[model samples]
Target chain A: MKGSLSDSTKRVMDIKNRKWLIAGGVVGLFLLASKLLQAVELTLPRVPLADGVDVAIEWATINLAPFFDGIKLVVIKLLVAITAFFDWVPWIVWVVAVGGAAFRWLGIRTAVFFLAGLLTIVSVGLWDHAMSTIALVSTSMVLILVTGIPIGIMASRNDRFESALRPVLDAMQTMPSFVYLIPVIFLLGSGKVPAVLATMIYATPPAIRLTNLALRQVSPEIKEAARSFGATPFQMLFKVELPLAVATIMAGVNQSLMMAISMVVIASLIGAGGLGNDVLFAMSRVRVGDGFEAGLAILVLAIVVDRSTQALGQRASKETRTE
Target chain B: MAQEGAPKLSVRGLWKVFGHESTGGIVPDEIANKSKEDMREDDGAVLALKDVSFDVNEGETFVVMGLSGSGKSTLVRTLVRLIEPSYGQIIVDGDDILQYSEKELVDFRRRKTSMVFQHFGLLPHRSVLENAAWGLEVQNIPKAKRLQIARETLDLVGLSGWEDYRPGALSGGMQQRVGLARAIAADADILLMDEPFSGLDPLIRRDMQGELIRLQEHLHKTLIFITHDLAEALKLGTHIAIMRDGVVIQIGTGEEILEAPADDYVAEFVQDVRRTTVVTVRTIMDQPDLKLRQSTTPAVAMREMGQAGVVSAFVCDEEDHYLGMVSFNGAAEAKQRGDATIADAITVDEYPTLPADTSVESALPVVLEHHNEGALAVTDEEGVLVGTLLPSSVVGAMAQEAQDATDHREASAASLEASHADDQEEADGDGDSEAVDPREGMEVS
Candidate 1:
């Protein structure tokens, strides 16, 4: 009597129509809510919390220093050691390593940037200093990864832990670079230790935040499936959850590396040695040419580290996708 | 072969509550303290599972059929202690598994059971072989032995050559097969499947269902399958448990459940069951008992039909092969017109003949489509007439069966209530005189 169609066809049509309406409503509601929220925020008067209660920045910086310093020292030492090993091997080894990394990450053109950048540093007689800087960033990244991942996992599992850590992460991400120096200068005192400490504090938030987010984003269905198969909590974490979140964690590492390099230059103001010190010294004497040279050297160092780490992250993702 | 002993798995009085306002968190108030109407309205504390109990007989396909959020998945999970029940006892082979510690639970999972999920849950980073071997490896089986077993299992599921491909490289159906292969390789006694074929295309789903049936026929492993598809339940389940909300509404054999549904919900579920696909010809066939006459001429054909007391006759050639049919009217018309040859006038391939092995269910469609007046002839492979099924007879048989089913349901419900009232009378200590069956009083229906 009705439209003599199959029941399944009708069901599918109904589902599609429902999905379309839902999508439209979601978008419209999101725009309207944002507009309303913005208006409310603009109309509301601003008020500051009690002066002593504003401990977000202070606590974040204080907690961040030791971790950052530990990272910087590890990076510098590793870089120096790697460079010394490379110096003994044939120049072709360097070519191959950079070439392989370049091809993997940003492709051939960026690989050229990588090669040219390295060559320029060598040509300018700043290879050793560049290696030390490279070492500092790598070491910082390693420490950050080791510490941040566990904290992230914990935060993801416990809602209270995550909520408690939120303000600290926010403050670490937003605090001025110069403000990081005030506390580290008082506790660790100006030098490589303070500078490393400062860089760690500046660079750790992204890693922690990303790790937490990645772990949280893992599909509940996947976890339930794993559990039903009799995976112990620990086994589930290592074998299922961590492996699934590998790509996001790698991206977090890339962010951390970028942050560390930016901090390295700022750390130079606290009397930490490297291209930062080189540029700072050049600037203090009104020597524009020397300062420009040192600045270029820092740029070269940043590009090499950024490309290599990014390439590593890309490789991890590619391997994951293939599986 | 049915084992004469206790079931392989048994659950008793399982309860899981969430968001309860309590400090110690040790006990839950009895559901009877609240009325059915109040329970439906109150959303404060969600009761995921409430006094759910069942026994999974060894080597039998016990299906838990329920819609999403009906606690079927939760029930399965709790049996394995994936989500701990607030109050319950699970006896696996007569051992109270609910008392098992963490390590003991791990040991139980490793040795006693394996699960297949709706989403397949194959490790995305591992090859098919590696993924299949994961469960064995977790139990510390030697890599070589595990891989060898994994290979055999994959071959069993028709994925022998794709062992090196990751789950991402395979289609959804193949991935599910791989998941199945993984569970089989674990060599667990009980296999728990939670809507394992729900995410596949209809054709693939049917194929997988057939594959599972074939596998079960060979292996005869204990299976507790959960699905929302009524058709799948009827096809695979030796016994089906229909659940609603957080409780099982009915548990019985497929035929029993279909013949006499427990309630309005189950009745509604089976309302659209296409009888054409479910009934068989054996249920409707009648034995042939009539005199036969050899007639080649139109006048002889009329005489034979008049003597047989039937509407139609199966025509045959000299070799005894089926030709078609000759109706009484046709024979009489030819005789009156002075047709000399009955063979020349008889209709060839005029009658629709179905095989004896075919279900009355499948034949209903063929009969309806062709608009046949009466029974279609049944034939053998050699095209010899075996029997005939009338359209009127099938319709009449089906209507009678439906009526009987309804009557049976009502009788069963009355008996169930009577037994429940006796139990309540025994439990009454203060002589309140209010009898109630805890199960009947449950809000599931």
Candidate 2:
């Protein structure tokens, strides 16, 4: 009986070996066939996918000219207003306000870190560029929030919508950030509006994904308890689900801010003026010192924004958490 | 719309089959008729609740008791339509809730029923007061009024000072108190508690059980409680339904189930229950062997006691209000001393009197302290003498229960053996063989 078991196993091994032999034979036959056909050049006719995309973009540019102009005008006005506001405020006042907020929510150490980071930007003679970059990132974040949060909420509620959204988010995150510039420049033209529009496309996925994940992660018992109490769907979402998920959603917002900051240099390639413009100018001329200065200022901004948003997320969670 | 004397909540022919189909889908007759195990194994479906029906009277605590997977939880959830049943009627105050629209169902839940979860399903983000007010909050009550009501309910549940604290800060027992306060603040007529204390420590669980009993004393709400603990079921339930394999095996009071179980399964289920804690004196009390009137002389009481072959006698007034126990020897001593009446002979202060409704466990100490007299007076709520209880009698009743259970089990096994013999004969018949006479081959053992 022992030998019988081993014999059956041996038979199984023989079958596996035969299967591999057959696979190798098929591969060899394909290779031999290809060698035999080498005399004739065989090629597939290319699909006109690139041409089709170009035609679609051309059609949208011509037919949706008014719609694109309306969006561009709104973006220009918002950018001008925000840039003017930053110009109007003294650098010290901006620093003090941010530093005071950091002190209040995060503590003295974080406050000192924020003050040092801001003063470094001013000391390096990149204060104007830094302010402009802040303005652009702020505007992009506003657009992202307005669009991303609602989409996230809808995805959380509907399974089919969530499934459909998953692949689109995957594509948005995984595709090269540079690719978004072409479509925006083609539609909205080359300026701050296109830059802002490009940043919106690149940075919005995290906000939608994190918000959906947070809402979906709320405990089933809590949801059932809410429902058993006869809460209308609206009440359940507002009173129970959103309140619990606010911390994680704030985390999504933080991710969006970081993504917007990272997009600043990329945004400058399309003639959007900011710290990104300084860095891009230095790269074209090969001025290492100027590029390093601009890069340093961007780094300081990213760190301060990241830490501040993180602190905000932490504060939200603390407010909801039991002591 | 409530009809005259309609039950507060009535569930009829409720069926919940999971993994069968989507909502409002009918289970095929072939699938429905198969046993739960077979359906799960062969059809990739679960019979969560099968043909379950029960009525909860107003102010009665109806306990659904089962081990895990017996579908008691599913049954309770179906009552509120939290888990929609495949087929059922849930009539609440004479209106079928199964037929309600979404709005009407929400209205019914807000006004009528509130559930307490075993896991204390409190909003961790909300303070205790806010959590308690949640049911009302969803109903859109004003904040001030709801908070006031919540504060009062917290006080009722002994959590007054902890109103502002979050649920996570509290211990398991205190958290469940918050759960209770939440349900109470709803002021719903029907409170559904799904194994509410099953997650607590044993000591804390006992305290919570006592707390619920205390609340129910004043609240008198219609409670449908689910529990796997038999002791908890017997202690809390006014009427209990025992479920197994998604089917109810029996429904009766604790004493009725203890005394004459409907089937062998119930008999076996109740075998481990300690009768001394569950059986009340009312169930085990007997008519006194001898009784003496206060006006009767000691000589007359002694003669009555001797004639009745009892060592002790209960003395009562002309209206049968219990006086005290008068021992035969004491009466004899009084007669020899030429006392005027049996009043002096009656040992009133030494013997302990028990209320007829008190459990034997509660009366055990007093019974033991006065076991010399061998009997104690049992009286109704109004102090009218009803019957007598003996310490020996309690032990005898408990012993009799154990004997009866054993006898019942033996009888059941014998019957099972007889049925198996019949089955064997049928199998033998399939082979075209002569059917052996069952009695001749049956072993006596």
- Model 2 clash number: 0
Model 1 lDDT per residue over B1-445, tens place: 2245988888887776554431222234655355444655786667777777889888999999876777888888877877777676788888878778778888888888999988787777778998899789788789999999999999999998999987898988899999899889888889999888877766677778878987898778899999876677767887899988788989997656766789977865554343334445544666443322234777776676677777767677666566676777877787788877666555656566677656445565677765655667666678766666777666776676677557666664566346444532432222232221111111110
Determine the backbone clash count of candidate 1.
Answer: 13
**Model 2, span A27-128: residue lDDT tens:** 999999999998998899999999999999999999999999999998889888988998899999999999999899888998998899889889988999
Where model 2 places Cα greater than 4 Å from the true spot, the runs are: A1-38, A103-113, A321-323, B20-34, B37-43, B288-353, B368-377, B382-386, B390-392, B398-445
TM-score of each: 0.69, 0.83
Per-residue alpha-carbon lDDT of candidate 2 for residues B1-445, written as tens digits (9 for 90 to 100): 8787888998887788887643433345775678878977886888888877888899999999876678888888888889888876888999988888899999999999999998788999989999999999998999999999999999999999999888989998899999999999999999999989877766667778778888999999999999876677888889999998788989999888877888876765566565666778888888988778888898888888888888888888899999888888988898899998998887788777788877766666678787876778899988889998988887787677568657766675566446445543432223221122211211111
**Chain A accuracy as TM-score for every candidate:** 0.71, 0.88
In model 2, chain B matches the true chain B with a TM-score of 0.77
